[model samples]
Target: MINHGKELFSAIVPTEQKGLKRKIYVITKAFIKL
Candidate 1:
């Protein structure tokens, strides 16, 4: 159970990071347009 939880957590973390990076990229582009 602990191992399964760890795997699930690791998978979620990368997805969250990707979302965060995308958000930052969009914000940066908006700033550049200004």
Candidate 2:
């Protein structure tokens, strides 16, 4: 159960990181347009 939780956490972190990066990129682009 612990191992499975660790695996799920590891998988989730990267996807969240990628999403955060994409959001930052979009915000930066919007700032550049202004």
Superpose all Cα atoms of candidate 1 onto the true structure and report the RMSD in Å to 1 decimal.
Answer: 12.7
The residue-level lDDT of candidate 1 at 7 comes to 56
Per-candidate TM-scores read: 0.47, 0.47
lDDT of each: 0.60, 0.60
In the range 1-34, model 2's lDDT, one tens digit per residue, is 6775565556556667578776566556545655
lDDT of 1 by residue, 1-34 (tens): 6775565556556667679776556556545655
Report the Cα lDDT for residue 14, model 2: 65
Evaluated at residue 6, the lDDT of candidate 1 is 67
Q: What's every prediction's RMSD, in angstroms? A: 12.7, 12.4
Question: Among all windows of ten consecutive residues in candidate 1, which has the lowest summed lDDT?
Answer: 25-34
